[model samples]
Target: MSAASRAGSLPANLQGLWADGLNPPWSADYHININIQMNYWPAEVTALSELHDPFFRYIERLLPHAERTAKKAYGCRGAVAHYTTNPWGHTALDGRIVYGLWPDGLAWSALHFWERFDYTRNLGFLRDRAFPILKACAAFTLDYLVKHPRTGKLVSGPSNSPENTYIAPSGERGWIVMGAAMSQSMAFAILSRCEQAAALLGVEPELRARCREAIANLQRLEIGSDGRLKEWPEEFPEAEPGHRHISHLFGLHPGYEIDVDETPALAAAARKALDHRLAHGGGHTGWSAAWITLFWARLGEGERAWQFFEKLLRDSTESNLFDTHPSGGGPIFQIDGNFGGTAALAEMLLQSHAGRLRFLPALPKAWPSGRVRNLRARGGAGVDIEWKDGQAVSATLRPETTGTHRLIAPQGQRIARIEANGKSVAWKDEGVRLARGVVYRIAFQPAG
Candidate 1:
């Protein structure tokens, strides 16, 4: 997926020569709910930054169709995509409201631009290309939101939690509801990215202010009565206790809002939700298992993360390391699991989602010696690390731009010395201010 995406020649789903029969399932279209998005999870982080171009190009091609979808279907401004789209940028619905009514698709797509900006810090790209798409999506989010009658909070309505259903308090099963946490979280992310873009570009003050105001009115994620993060705004019983899609945890992974340090309660609720899902039969599919691995890494649980990683490799992978989904009879191929697992492994080695470049946050004991190069991080940094006995022996960080970066060294490791291009330097607990194109090396030993 990374190589093909980098070449800009990969299909939305890479069936290659393996595609069977005339009527392949789903017509080989990009399923935006999670599949297409999952395929690119490793691109930027693994330093295949150029791979994002094809996706952005696809988004650009789809914008006009998406705009029509938004205006015609919801009477709202901006763009919208259904569950699936072909290479030609078709944006029509799939006829099933359960997965079809998800307007969050474009909002979620906008996040790729945000992720690219996070990795590159290329203000020109953010201003000229990424911000326009994000701002348009934010406009859609603003226009698409309806006031919840009970709480008056801005909410999205008549949307399912992306292929999942719930039972209401009135004993009726429904796929449509107001404020599926996935949509809310995606909107929040879009708006947050727009605000940040505006700040970086030093333009669009009105848009930034509007985003701030709308953010205030957006629905808040709440822990359900079951001690888990609610999939929908209300405490509805899950139609499938072990549903494969962990949509409610959107804010926890891929999205930036929920953090263990900042929102411990929500973090705990996310963990509980995962436990609930796993206690049933969730994470059975390859992509879902990959997502679970990512969640565990985000929670800083290396052992649990490694366990799931192993599970994905064992049960959900083909001989070529491509991911496979479980059919009633046997395994079926899916590209998302492969890409998502790639991202998950990178996360286990190094994480930057919490606004800090954390080294070896979830390095598993199984991988005692390894080296990774050219993993991108937020704040315009590139990282390369080598570890032995699960301990970071040395790591090099290159700053593409000059800034003070909050650096989190490997847990339980003490820095024996730090140097910038061989010159000894003082490392501050707050952060290290770096110059453009300069490399900082840290020599560390295990903590006693």
Candidate 2:
């Protein structure tokens, strides 16, 4: 996947570098709703940041076309891209309204920019490349959002949860509705990031203030009566109980709004939602199962994560190792699942999203001993870990910037020793502050 998305060229599409025939599946096009975005999920975490360049370039090229679509389609400011796009930068809505009318593509796609900046801590990239796109996305979201008549909270309307539908109480099957969980989550992600970027750059005071106020007024994720995260503003019956798309869990995985530690309640709701989906035969496809694997890893369910990972491999994989999406005729190749599985495996080993590097946060008992080398983390750090009996035994940390680094012992183990360039370094439960370009080695053992 990384090789397919070289810099100065188009990002990897559905077929990636290979197309089976002259008339490839979905024309091997860019699907912004999730497919295209999922293609790059492993780029930063798996130590392939350069592979993300083509996607960023693609987003940059999308600006002009997206701007026109935002105005012509919805008369909104800034920009909006719908569910699908192509190399020529077609930002217009395509296909049926159920799957095509979504206007949050630019917001979700722009998150790659923020993720890159967050991982690299590149001020120049954030300033010159990312913030502009983020700001534009925020601008469009602010203009697109409106106060819900009853709830009085800002909500996105006429947008479905990325191809999922619901049956209203009146027995009407509907795809478009107000305040879809995925839409709100995407809005919150983009707006909050924009505010952070503005604060970091010390520019766009008015835009920053608007974003802050809008965030305050945005509808929060709600827990349904069934203890699941509400997919829509109301408790409408799902058109398909086991729908393949679990867009409501977007905040839990790709977005950091929901966390197992910080927002335990929301995390629980998300877990219930996932359970409900899987109980109803969700994750029936390769990419969907791969996404579920990542979600389980994020929620720290190592066994469940491993189960889904295996399902992705056994049920959705071809003999040649290509991810296969079920079709009317037979299973067909799709590249997102391959990339998503790579990212999920990396997530199971090390996670750095929660303000600290968590070593093997979701190491499954099935894999009692393992080693991973050169897994990248956010905030410009790299990690290499070796573990036995599900406990981290030794690890190396390489920071590209000077700062106070925080490292969490895997599975509640204790750090027994720390060495920096063969010299003992003072440390505590949190971690040690280190200079850039220094190699830190840590040894861990089971606690008590």
Candidate 3:
């Protein structure tokens, strides 16, 4: 979330449609898939890496499915993808456009791409495709939010948490509520990204106050005594003891509302709940596994982080291609899996740990010699990185408006590296660099 972080942009070579190499994708295996709700990124990354290499072409064949899944202003409801013939927009769900409402996963893609832009600043890619995706998805939310006539709370019903199903305290037979915690997290992130994009684009605006107001009033589904994130605001819900989706964790990971720094209690609450889910055999599906992996990474649990990652790759996908059962197990794959794994793998290498970019937190001890081409992390002053020989050999850092970076490396090491006036300079272990936004090189040459 610093200018320097955003300034570097993604290396163009890595920016193009990656078909193979690190993003290994394979064939459709699932017998039934109602992927109309949203596309999956975790599956897509794994598949895309496979497709990135020159030898890969199978992932491309899956594109027709993704294209069919794309929707214009509205997020596709169930069965929306298969029936629509147009390039975008859902025409029907179960053969009727009964509800073309804004959905959460659609909101995530908008935020995800915007965050990616900081690393992959392919403006043309963002402008032509990513921006529209963000704009329309966000516009739908802006348009869709309707205030209740009496209580005046913004309501988004027909919404679902997708993890635990609740029981009404009154015993009226409960169901998923609209704008639940999961949905709010998704919506909040979408709005925040919209605001960020607007600031970046200049030229125009939105009612910022109202956006913030929504953030303020957005309800967080309460936590039970068991410490697990609840399904809804009502009584103890009849939960899925082994389900894969931990939809509510959005506030904890990608959206980043709860963290040890700002919201310790909520962060603890989230972790408590997430841990319970994992302990209770709440399996990690492709996308869910990716999120769980990310959460562990964010929390600085390197070994557990690696374990969750393994489950995501191995447990799901046949031959490491599709997600079918737990830990991304589905015969037919979801595109989100690809993006999720890429993110998890990348995060293990480096992280913007609570707005301070730290390198290599949760990498598996054995894996050696790998590189992440152009990943971005947010720090107010410097964009720092070091990669080579499966370790960060040297940190090439740039400062935004001349600032400092508290550089943390593998094994919990820390150093202060500075940058001034956009120029790379030699710096001491403690600190060195210009004050007005410069680039600096911090070397960690291996013993000869």
Highest TM-score against the true fold, candidate:
2
- Tell me the spans in candidate 1 whose CA falls farther than 4 Å from its real position: 6-11, 14-18, 446-448
Query: Tens digit of lDDT per residue, candidate 1, span 256-375?
Result: 778887899999999999999999999998999999999999998999999999999998888888778777767777678888999999999989876677888889889999999989
CA displacement after TM-score superposition, residue 29 of candidate 3 (Å): 12
- Per-residue alpha-carbon lDDT of candidate 3 for residues 1-448, written as tens digits (9 for 90 to 100): 0110122222111112232455433322111111221222222222222122211121122233433443432343211122221222322233222112224434554454564454334455456545655665555566556564555666555555552555567655444565567666666777666666665666236545556667666555567677766655443555464556666776766667776656777877887877877887765566667668878877667677788778877866567464443324425345445446666776676766454456677666656655543444443233345555455555655544444444566653443333334444555544343344445655553333
Worst 10 residues of 1 by lDDT: 10-19
Local distance difference test, each candidate: 0.85, 0.91, 0.51
- Model 3 misplaced regions, further than 4 Å: 1-88, 91-102, 121-132, 146-153, 170-173, 220-222, 284-287, 320-339, 364-394, 398-411, 416-439, 443-448
Number of the top lDDT candidate: 2
lDDT of predicted model 1? 0.85
Models ranked on lDDT: 2, 1, 3
Candidate 2 lDDT at 277 equals 88
